[model samples]
Target chain A: MIKQFPIQQFLDENGKILNKDIRSQITTELVKNFYQHCVRIRTFDRKAISLQRQGRIGTYAPFEGQEAAQVGSALALQQDDWLFPTYRDHGAAMTFGHSLRNILLFWNGRNEGCIPPEGKKIFPPAIPIATQIPHAAGAAYAEKRKGTKNAAIVYFGDGATSEGDFHEGINFASVMKAPVVLFNQNNGYAISVPINKQMSSQTIAQKALAYDIPGVRIDGNDIFVVYFETLKALERARQGQGPTLIEAVTWRYGAHTTADDPSKYRDQTESQQRRHTMDPLLRIEHFMKNEGMYDEHWINEIEEAAQAEIDLAVQEMEEFPVANPADIFDHVFAEPTWGIQKQKEEYLRLLEVNP
Target chain B: MMNTVIQTKTLTLVQAINEAMDTMLKENEQVILLGEDIGKNGGVFRATDGLQEKYGEDRVLDTPLSEAGFVGAAIGMAVNGFRPVVEIQFLGFIYPAYEQIMTHASRLRMRTMGYYTVPMVIRAPYGAGVRAPEIHCDSTEAIFTHMPGIKVVCPSNPYDAKGLLIAAIEDPDPVLFLEPMRSYRSVRDEVPDGKYIVEIGKGNRLIEGEDVTLISWGAMVPVALKAAEQMKVRGIHCDVLDLRTLYPLDHELIAESVQKTGRTVIVHEAHATGGVGNDIVSIINDTSFLFQKAPVERVTGFDTPVPYFGFEDHYLPTPKRVVHAIEKVMKY
Candidate 1:
C-alpha cells in the first residue's frame, strides 16, 4: 500500500525548532558560514538578473528563494564527489568551488564558463531537462567499480522528473546500487506550467517508490534539515547502501529567467507573502537572534564582502579576451575531420575575399 | 614498436569486435564495458560475448534496460576520466538516448570549449538486410551525421571494425561505431592480431576504375563491390570507395575519385532525400563539379520507413540498381 511521506523540517517558518535533537547540532560557526554563503549567492543571483536586464549578459535564471537547498546540499558533498547541476543550479556550483568569474562568462555565452575548475568534478549545467540524471548515475557507478568510496549528487527541478531520463536514471541506480543522490527542488513551475498541471502524482518523492529507493521530502527553506539529510543520504551511498532521492520542497520568487515574466501566470502577492514567512536566509537570521548570536556588525561585514567579491568577478568576466571564431571548428574531434577542415578553410577564405 | 611485425587472424565481424574489446580491456584498466545483456549474456548480438567472463563483473557491466540512463552515465564516466564503451541494442531504440548523445555527449567538447572531452565509444548494430523485425533495421545514419562535434563511423568488414572500434575508444572524443547487422557473420576477413589503428575520418578506396566512382559504407559496401564486379564484365570499370567515417567524410578521396572518373553514383540503405549520399554528392559538386562528365546518380532506398520482409529487397539498394545508376551515368 502506498503511504504519505511527510515533509521533514528541523527549523519551522517562525524560527522555532520542531526537532529538539537538532538543537545541539546548530553551532555558531556553522550558522555564520550558512549566513555568509547565503548572502553571497543571493547577491550574485540579483547581480546576474541586473546584468541580463542591461544586456551585459544573456538570459539568466535566478535562484532568489532557493539558497538553502543549493548551499546545504552542496556543503554536504565531499571534495572528490561529483556534482551534476542544471541551468538554475549555478548557486550550488559556486558554493562547490566553481569560479564566480566563470559563472558570469557562462551567462555571457562563452564556453569557458561551462568548465569547472581543475580537480572539481562539477559537470557543465545540463540545459536539457533531466539529461544529467543518467550521467550522474554512470559516473557514480564508475567510482564503485574502481573500489573508490566517492559518490555523486545531481540537481534537478520538479519539472525535470517528468522526462524519461528521470525514471531511467532512478531505475538503473536502484538496480546497480549506484552511489548517487537525486536532489530535486520542487519549485512549482516549469516555464509557467505549475506542478499540478504537469503531473497527476501528489509528490515527486513518491516517484522514487516505483524504483524502490529511499525518498525524502524536506523543507528546503530550512538549511539545517537540507544539510543533515543530504549528509545522511551521501553517507548511505559511501557505505554501499545505494542511492537516495531527495525532494526539496521549495519556491521560486523570481521569473524562470530574465526573458520570462512571472506576473502573467501567478500572483505576485503570494510571492511577497512567502518572502517574509519562508525565506531561507531570514529563517537563519531569526534562529541566530533566538540563540543570541545576531550581530549588525557581522551582517554588514558579510554584505560588503559579498558585494566586493561579485564586483571583482564581474570585472574579470568582462575583461577576458573574446573567444576566437576558429575555436568553433576546432575540438569537434580531437583531430578535426576532413569535412570540418574543409569547412573551416572555406569559411576563412570567404572572410578574406570579402575583406 | 613501429618496426614490429603485425600478426593477422581470420574471424567474423562480431568476433573481431570481441577481440578488439578483449585486447583493449586487458591492456587498459581504465576501459570498462556497460550495456544491457552485455555481461553474462555477452550481448544480444554476441558482439560482446564472453568479455564479461574474461574481464569480471566490475569491468564488464550488465546494465538494466535503460538506454538514456546508461548512455548518459557513460558520458559522466567519460568526463571523470574513465573510458566507457556503451552498447545500444538496436539503432532504432536509440531514440530514448538521443537526448544524451546529441544534446550532451556531442556538444560537451564544443560547449565547454575543450575544457572537457568525452572519451567514449557507443556501439550499436545498425542497417538492414538480415530481415530484422522492426526498429532494429534502420540504416539511417544521417540522423547522427547531421550532428556536428561527433564522429560517425561504420566499418564494412572485420578488419576495419576491429581497428576503428579500438581507435574510437582511445580517441579523446565521443564516437558512434555502427556495426551493420548484415555484416555480423556474413562478412569476414583476415583481421590482424594485437593492436592496430585504422584512422577515423579517412576513406578506404577498395577498388579503382575510370568509368564511375561508386561510393558507399556499412552494409551497402558489399552491394557496391558486387555492382562494380558486374560492371567490369561490360568493360565499365568503376572505383569503389568505402567511407569508413561519415561525418568527417574523406572528401579528398571522394574528390580524387570523382575527378578521375568524371562521374559518380552514390549508394546507401537510407532514404535518398536526407541520406549521407546527398552530402557526398554536395561535396563532390562543390569541389569536383567542374570536372564532372555527367550528372551524379544515387542508388538509395526509397524515402520511407524500412518496410517488412515482403518488400525488403525491393526497398534496399540492390546491385542491379547500382549497375543501372552506373550505366545511366556512364551513358550521359
Candidate 2:
C-alpha cells in the first residue's frame, strides 16, 4: 500500500537530486525565477506579520513555512488562469500579481484589500475553508463550456478536506471534466486541531481517490518538485483531462494566525527543529550550491529587490485614505435596498449625534 | 373602429422562476446557473427544467453538493466579470456558505472601494410549508437580513417570481432569492415572454381596504390575500401589502398602508421570534405608531423548529390565522 503512495520528489532535503528523470527540467533560468518569487513572498509574509504585531493591520493568517507550496504553485500559472485563494494564501496571491498594498489594506480591515488588480482572475481570499473549491469547479466548468484553454486552481489547507464542499468540488470537477487543480497544503493543523484529530484518512491526497481523481503527494519543501508537478497538473487540466489533487506536505512555522498561540498546543522547539532540516529556502540554496550555480551577488540582489518592493508597498498602503464607516452598508447590493438605506441613514445619524 | 384582445397563460411560482432564468440565460451570455442537480435534473422541483438543454451545459452548470464551495465560487466568478446565478438546494443548507456570502461576497466591493462587485444571485427554496426534513424547510431570511451585505428577495407569485429573479440576476450586488417550496407548483399566473425586471426593494399592493393592513411575503402572501378576502365579507376591509424584497423592504408602501388602515397585522411563515414579521412590526412602530388604530398584531409560525411533514401545515401560518389577527385588530 505504501509503495503505491511513495512521496514523489525531484530534490531532497540534503540538496541531492532524487529524481534524475526530471533533473533537466530545472534550468538555470527556472531556478533563479523560482528563487526570486519564493524569496519575495517570504519577505512579504514577514512584513505582514510585523504589521499585524504593530497593530497597523488587523488580524492576519501567516503562511511562513509553506512558502514553497505557494510560490511554486503560483509561478506555474499563466496570467489568464484563475486563482481561488484562502485567507492564508496571500503569499500565493502576491506572487500571482495581486497588489501588495491592497493586500495590506485588506488586513487593515479595509474592504479595498479584497480587490484584485485590473483584469487579473484572482478572487478575494475566502475565509470559510473549502468554500472556494466548488467555485473553482464551476469556473473551470464555465471555461470548458466556453471552449477556453484556461484552467482554474484553488488553494486550501489540510482541515478544509473534511468540509462537504471539498468533496463536492472534486466530485463535480472529476465527472464534468472541468479544468481545475485542487491544491492542498497539508500544514498539519487547522487552528489547534491536529490532522490526526481532524480526520481518519492517512493523507488528504487519498481523499481524491474516492472521487476517482488522480492524487499526488509531494515533498512541498522541494521547490523544484512543486513547480514542475504543478505545471504538469495545469497542463493536464487545460487538455480537458479533468481536475487533479496535489497534496503538498508542508508545515506552518508560525501560529495559525496573529491572534493564535501555537505554544498552547504544540512544542515550539519541534517547529524550530524542522526549520533547520527542511527550510524550503535553505534547501534551494543548498541545491544551487551543490550544482555550483550559487552566487552571493545574485542572492544579495534578490533580497534587496524584495525588500525595496515591500517597502514601497507599505508606503502606498499607509498613504491610502481613511475608510468611511458608511462604506460598510454601501456595497451589500448593487443598489442598496430600502432597509439598508434606512439602516445607513440611522447609523449616520447616530454618528452625528454622538460626535 | 378596431378591437383589441389580451392573451394570458397561467403558470406556477416555480414555472415563473424557470421562465425568468430561461429568459435571462437566453438574453445574457454573462448570466449562468450552478447548483446541485440544477442541470440535468432541472432542480429537485424541476424549476430549472430545459435550461441546460437550451443554454447548453456552460450557461446552466450542475454543481456538486458543496453549497459553500459553489456559492463562494459564484462570488469569484461574479467578481471576475460574470453574473452567476447559483442555487442552494434548500434554505437550511445555506449555513455552510454563510461566511462566504457575508464575508467575501457581501464585503468584497466595499472592501475594495467599489473596485469589485459580486454580481451573483443565490436562489434557494425556503420557508416551512411542504414539511421536508428538519433542515430542509427553515425560513432564514431574518438571518440574511441581519447581515450587512447581500440583498434578500422573497417573491410571492408567478408574476413577482419571474420579474424579481430577473432583477436579482441583473443586480450588481449579491442577492439571496428565497423561493417558497410549498407554492412552487401550487400558484400560477400569466408571465410575460419578453425580458422584464422587477425593481428590488419595492412592495406591491394586492388589495385595497380601510380597516387594517396585512403585510407578508412568500407563502404568507397568499395567506394574507385569502384573509383579506374573508375579512371583506365581515365588513372589515383589509389592505394586503406583499413585501417582495425582505431586506430592502418597501417601507414607504408599508407605512402608507398602515396609515391608511390605521391598523397593522404582520404575517409570515417564519418563526415568530425575530422573524421578518418582527422587523416589519418594529418599522411600523418606529415610523407610524401614532397612525395606529390598534397595536400591531403579528401572526407568525410558532417559535419552534419547523415540525415534521405530518404537522407542518399546523405549524405554518395559515389564512385562518391571518384572518383571526385581522379581526382582532379591527375589533381593537
How much TM-score does chain B earn in each model? 0.98, 0.96
lDDT of 1: 0.91
- lDDT score at residue A120, model 1, on the 0-100 scale: 90
Name the candidate that leads on lDDT: 1
Share of true Cα-Cα contacts across chains kept by each model: 0.80, 0.65
Model 2 pairs in collision:
A111-B111, A111-B112, A112-B111, A112-B112, A135-B73, B11-B188, B11-B189
Candidate 2 residue-wise lDDT, A1-355, digit = tens: 2366667788889889888888777788888887898899899889988988888888989999998989999999999999989999998999999999989988888778888899888877878778788778877877887789999999999999988778877877898888999999998999999999999877778877788888999888888888888999999999989999999999999999999999999988989999999999988889899989899999999999999999999999999988787877776666666667778999899989996
Shift of residue B130 alpha carbon in model 2, Å: 5.0
For model 2, residues B1-332, the per-residue Cα lDDT tens digits are 26744444588889889989988888899998989998899999898998999888878888767777678667756755689999889998999888778777877776666776788999999977665788899997899888777789999899989999999998888889999988898888887776778999899998888888888889888888888888888788888889899887788899899889899999888888888888888888888989988988999888888888789889888888888888788788
What is the lDDT for B245 in model 2? 94
TM-score of chain A of 1: 0.97
